[model samples]
Target: MPSTPHRWITTPLTAGLVRGALDLEPTAQGILPHRLPAWARDQNTDGQLAMAESQPSGVRLVFRTRATAVELDTLPTKRIYVGAPPRPQGHYDLIVDGRPAGRAIATGGNTVTIDLGTGALEHGTGPVATLRFAGLSDEDKTVEIWLPHNETTELVALRTDAPVRPADASGRRTWLHHGSSISHGSDAASPTTTWPALAAARGGVELVNLGLAGSALLDPFVARTIRDTPADLISVKIGINLVNADLMRLRAFAPAVHGFLDTIREGHPTAPLLVVSPILCPIHEDTPGPTAFDFSRLGDGRLLFTAAGDPADGAEGRLTLNVIRDELERVVARRAANDPNLHHLDGRDLYGEADHRELPLPDRLHPDAATHRRMGERFAAHAFASEGGPFAEAEG
Candidate 1:
């Protein structure tokens, strides 16, 4: 007889078992709802703890398996709950092993059942869904089980033989990064191309991405979220979003940063936390941002900025990368005496003087895929490497 197949069993446990199982927080603010296992809670606008409202709409479960042969089995009676407030009409893609396995449609109601194969699973809302797996080899693979627009639905329970634990059981190290849309991977060709993802790959460390597009306003909840998690390495890319949104003034920026770091220290007493400012953005490099424009096209196929000469052009202390960089250094320097683990990385160092000449960030805001690759390489060399280097000692 052939050898008996080896299998492990996974069942739902108290939320407590899931807590601290990973270094990252499962909750996210803004358009995306907080996604926690059945046992976790969501934070309110006032930063108070509340029952989690719904599931997340994007990638959630991600893990790598060492086993060459894998099998997934779930309870046959599982029922997907489509809660009240029907979601937008869209089809959901079921992806397994990073490839499409099948699709679930949400035409009217919210709930849909899917049959994902033995591989990983990913689901997304869509009209045209395609599941393709053409080049998968028989070996250990990283699995990403995704649910797009899942905030409108809930994954009541998941049963599988694949281990629920992280790939790095040894707990060698951790890297936590907080940034804007770029870090959140707005326009990357693929999920792994994001700078944070790329850097994590090169550094040989686990990554926790706290990137929120138009949402990294130095919120206390975010600081608390970072504080609550444990990490071996930490970095925060600030400025660009603040400038773009005109969220704060000079008077409010410094103290907010101090408080954010203070809160993080409360959780990670000695973990290295590097504060990074924005890279060169020609529009806001020297000029105050919060710039607005009205796109009006002439009879010809040409566009013009109607609000180019608006009165709000140069309000006092408006957002600017140069201004933020100066202030960020001052803030880090002031806190360094008491917090030895704190450091700063000027964003320009990652993509500055020389890079702009060759590969400018498309749209003057978010870096293109090439920029992400370049930035990831430089970040690994200077910060993530374990050997004695710029940030190695502080990281520990």
Candidate 2:
């Protein structure tokens, strides 16, 4: 065992800025991050909702330290889908002085096993584990520990070889983004690698992500949350979750969008608000969904989702990606004529047919890590570039 340093400082976890999480509450074990606040979470009792809200998709611990070594204690609940391949271990992405430093995985927490055959869940709790990083430069620098995007983690403690302080704001524009699983980092490599996070880094902006997996159903509560939050730039990525859940028809989706935007506008009446439609998801482009898990591939240790709705259902108002894109374009165009602060970006521009050929979405529903990187880079160029961009004039 390595000898312990003679002196160390323990900082309260709350001392570090935690972005992207809507709520933080004390748990029996530690402080748990919630993408949705307790009141919002209380409105839904579904297991999927519970799991998704607790995952802390874009939450990160950011502080300034001169420590040569640091340690974080966390109790993570790792989920296991029975009959499928084991998930990769949850990881914390470490960023030092605005650059990727390394990654660390905490071991021995809790395991949640789900049986597909019976729809039963078995949870086993374990002890908290430490993730230690050593050999740092020992110079005062900003340190960001991006929480695991997939696992439900409860932060236990933060310890360092030297004192730490909250990091100073970089005076960059704050980008507040809301969307579905793709934005929530579905299959991205790590929390910092998620498309939104990547775009933030590329654009030199601070990010407050409101992407919620299996939960971006254009809910009014979410809209109000975004409206209330402080942001210099705002974006709402819509469509996929509604289609996959078969939540509503076109008649409802359009009005729901209007209402959602209305709520956001109530708080951010003049902030540059960008409306983004769904990307080119071939399976859901023309076909409506009620996406289903492809069990045939599950036997091969792969979990894939396929659209189950009929293409002919369009006449019945079934929502599809194409329909969503058209509606979003119309909505943004109609409103933009009167509201110069509002803008629209075709999701296809971010991940379209051309990009799909080179870097495909591995699960057919979410972009892989590499695809995420591409999308981020493209979004930065299109939205944050100096000339002919919506944000160009606003920067000054």
Candidate 3:
């Protein structure tokens, strides 16, 4: 008798297997997941937000199968900064049965070259890359393939030695989070290790990360998106992007924050809604932003940022970390009096001045991998692990 040939089954990458995205766009080559729905995407025109939402930070392909071998074809948008050393390749993290199993990277895909100094751009395309994982346990198990947190990826195809189906529901609460680059896994070791991801795992909750890089500017559309989304627990990390982008003055910031929270309350009237202020960033602690790249570091191929706005500008309502924090606390306090579920978490508690002394932010903006871990652990303790904490009831 002839030996049986190895068998492989290919499946369409549909919304059934994708999580953490609000919409799925069909492409000729594959499916592109977007954190923002088509309607919200249409309401926005900012290229930065569009790019950030396109990156599937906390999104993952989750399914149940006994396949000992699996492969994923992806077209990733890789970035190359002119005159700078290439950044490390983004990682795809694998988890089995709620635990980390393995990791891999897709090699070829699209590349975008950007010149920071002149603001020039160029693009190139490469063959879709296939990432594979072998020697998995043959036992029926839930498999989760986490997309790269920092790269925009399109799912081209999935192949496994055995057929796959939707994973059994874990019966975990869904945690919806929105924040800036730090929460977007800017310098995280991998997709699954981002602070929000880690916190969700430890809290035993499903995560929907809307950490839209530099785009968390308290947009009404974003607030509307959050309002429409369904979640057991919701958190919005504000302040960092507002300061760093110098998007609005204090007068405008307060109403924006209020309106954002009000919109969410409209849809989730009784959900445990947590408002988080910006973490301790010494560079912008007191100084107003419009953060500018410290191009001086470019000589050594290092990227760093510095505050561009004058400190004295605060008298004119220029927003800073401290200013934002005070306003957020006030807003939550007033609302919590009548709305019992409303809560606030100072981002400093997650990554504060003490943390900065030991593990300074390498880029002066985003936390590094270790800080990510620390923030995640601290956040879990305060939000989910602590007695009578915001999400503790759900956790219990």
Candidate 4:
């Protein structure tokens, strides 16, 4: 550790470049990062939306410094279900000179406990925690700290042996992706290891992840957000959130999708826009959902999810993965006649029956870390390879 107190610089946390989040709100103790702007947030007061948007999945702190040692102070908000095992600490990934360097974990943070049956929430306060990394090369370099994807991180302070400045943008094409919890980094080992982050690295693009866990409900506000954000490439992963929530039937889903695409096109008329359907989830493959928490395993300290709707309910406009896939394909095909930039990809191509056999989803919902890696690699190859793929540079 550096001994000279006079040499240490306390850089304001707001000085670092924060990406992926749409807004940063100043709080009494620190700065709170939010995925949705204040306007969008005010539109809904649902706890689900509040929690999902506050977890900055792809947000990172990017700066340039010659410091060999650095420390960050943060207050993270972690959630725990009453009957489930305690959740793990949040992870912060560090990158130096565009390469993976090291990772650290935040030890103390506030905890929010929830009773699923009663819908009651209890909050507990915890002290802020410090994350420190040392032994970095003395030479000037760019540093990136990927914030915990599943935790609501409040930035308290940033200290380093040397002064810090925001790093220059890489000038890579920005790929804006919007999806559900799967895209929000659930079950992924770390923030940067999330499928979207991995795919961004492989595709050599900047990622603006608008993945709101359990909140990809085809809201007009979300479509407007996408329509207003600047981007070179855009993709929306549809269906899973809808099916699992059982929010809407086929009749409403089709028009909602069309409206969503129409809104996006108003801003990005020529950008390569890819529409991806849900990947195969065996439980939801033929069966409809409003997936329910499986409490059978809770006695053993294991929390699991199970499909709760009947497969035969499709006759009443219920949605299944199969039903969603067919409708998405038809919608894209019909719209593509006039919009050459629009394209569609079946989620099965990313993770199909064969892949599922080798790598199963732990919760029967979100993919595990290894599966996330596979999906990222496949997505890069399918959409970003030089072989006239949907996201080819030629389109630009």
Candidate 5:
């Protein structure tokens, strides 16, 4: 009897098969899920959760099974579309059955092509024959490919081996993160260097980055996106964007957050989701957010606020960090009795009083790389540490 080809090896963009034929299931678009490539797992590397960086080594694919004999087949000419950042520069490694197969490098946009060898059956009687790749650095990275498994085999598991320590699959765990431009990492450094990435590294769980720069509008879509993704933990950092963008009124803010969490419950059911409010922003701490500035002028003194109304004025719909924090606590308290998994973390807890006093955000918006590192460490200790309250059981 011949060994069976249990699973198909393809990029996330391409459809996967659960049993037999190609299953075209519609995944939630706009919202990005942290996915690991097959090759990442083969190499025993814990790939980044949400975003990936381009590396000189490409990703690989590995197959695990109980069959005695196995065969190897390569697609003639296939395109691997990568959801990478603009002007990506790196190489990709391709591996098969723990052997180096080939390499692919980023060209114009974010697509790489690899010509697999002849589609012939190779004899293999091992429990697992992993296809792996190397060559991704800490930059923006995303790739998709098409590798169809033989219809005769059984598909067991799929994963990516990233640089971080592999997470335990035993108990359920969830990680939630929130932030401003720095959290979103507008331009400071590479993709993997973002606070969310660092934090996820420390936590050892999947992440849903809700750090929308110039856009964390508390929009239904943002909340809906969070509500939709499955998770064991959750957090939301709100403030900077609201203040800088000057998008909401105080009256609407509290209810909006409630609605956001409420929506998330629809999908997550009973997962531990932490609600993180904004940190201390002096400019917006006492003043109402939604402040405006002219993009046309800056150094010339042409910059000016469009409105004189104070966000502190309770009469108006203006917002402030302090006010948002209070409301968040109230919202959680109101809903806590009904939902045991619901929790809240003050952003200040990660980078509060002392840290802010020492290092303020550059340009009054984003944190520097050091701050990102600190934030990651603090988050891990508070949210994911086993000895801690919320994530204690999860850590086990």
Candidate 6:
């Protein structure tokens, strides 16, 4: 808990003060940040996506202030694991002048518990919590207060020692990326530390992250969201969610992929578009899914994921990482011939068997903090390096 300041000035949270989110919804508490607009959200029935898109993976509050002390009142929704070790409270990271600065965690709010075996959920409500940061340089500087990547939060109020205003744009190209939990900051240390956020930092670009956890299926609405959003660079990391969720079989996947890309091209025909496949996940390398929680270690307060589909089922057109990767390669190769701005990068180039053996995923499904950093560094080098990168400034 931070000490309360004497003469606090309140600043309303507005869309202009936010960066990375597509829409802002007014809430009884204050405002809720949304990665997808209301219209797009209304089209989906999957509860996972509804939860994921509202988690605000790449969303942050960007403003200019000379306040040495700042306080934010928020109502964050946290997860409670029954019969398992507690999940850490989500983090609030502060970035100043493009540098890592302060970090805080909200104390209390709403909570939800999903039963491991039954898949049942229970909710608990709590009071709003205040996150505060004090004793900073008083001179004007841009401040980015990054919300948690794994928790949904409502902005109740913002107070500062000095008056605050929206920050100006960075004058960098905007990068729009969509993918699964890996891209959505699962197990990552914080919001800005997610692979996409880390890569965006290295690329010196504003970020529009659509990396919804466990919800990046080849949905038309997501494609439309990407199509309508303004972006200078675009990338889609596919395959993991499709495999783990077992949403569509091979017969439907190809056309779904084609249609998804076609929708994106309609709005961004000339934008440098990169199609990335899944990284190495040996568990799903050959096995199809429906990934299941590996309960063998739950007794030890550890949670791991395992593929639950049969191997012989491949003949039935079941989707696996290998099959998805191959099809994605073919799709990109064929499309690139006609669409010069379109490109493909094998996700293995970002994280392959060799790297996995060195730094395995902590939960067998998502990368840990260190792995996120490694992936971010590798992705940045491949996608943003001065020369030989498909996303180079002169790509289009």
Q: Each candidate's lDDT (Cα)? A: 0.55, 0.87, 0.91, 0.89, 0.48, 0.91
lDDT of 6 by residue, 1-396 (tens): 336556788898888898989999998889999999999999999988999999999999999999988899999999877766788779999999999899999987999997877778999999999988888899999999999999999999999989999988866899999999999999999998999999999999999999999998998999999999999999999999999999899999988999999999999989989999999998999999999888788778788889999999988999999999999999888888899988888999989989899999878988889889989999999988789786777745
TM-score of each: 0.65, 0.96, 0.97, 0.97, 0.57, 0.97
lDDT tens digits, residues 202-306, model 3? 998999999999999999899999999989999999989988889999888888888999999999999999999999999999999999988678778788999
**Span of 10 residues, lowest total lDDT, candidate 2:** 1-10
Candidate 5 Cα misplacement greater than 4 A, ranges: 1-179, 293-315, 394-396
Candidate number achieving the greatest lDDT relative to the actual structure: 6
**Model 5 accuracy (lDDT, Cα):** 0.48
RMSD of 3: 2.4
Q: Tell me how far the alpha carbon of residue 3 in candidate 1 is from the true structure, in angstroms, after superposition.
A: 26
Ranking of all predicted structures according to lDDT, beginning with the best and ending with the worst: 6, 3, 4, 2, 1, 5
Positional deviation of 126 in candidate 3, in angstroms? 0.8
**Backbone clashes, candidate 2:** 0
Give, for candidate 4, the lowest lDDT window spanning 10 residues.
Answer: 1-10
The per-prediction CA RMSD against the true structure, in angstroms, equals 9.9, 1.7, 2.4, 1.6, 14.0, 1.5
Cα error of candidate 3 at position 286, Å: 0.7
Q: Mind giving the per-residue lDDT tens digits that candidate 4 earns over 363-385?
A: 78989999999999999999998
Where does candidate 2 stray beyond 4 Å?
1-5, 393-396
Rate residue 310 of model 1 by lDDT. Answer: 24
Tens digits of per-residue lDDT for model 2, 340-377: 98999999999999988998777788888898888888
What would the per-residue lDDT of candidate 1 be over residues 1-396, giving only the tens digit for each residue?
Answer: 112333434433323222122222332111222422223233335211221123222333444544333222111111232221222232234334545544433232223433222223233432212222223344555544433321233223333344544333255467777777666654454445567767776776666666665556787777777777667778898988787667788888899988988888888888878898887767777666564532333234322222122235445666577889999999999889888778888999988968888986555566777988888888888786667543564443
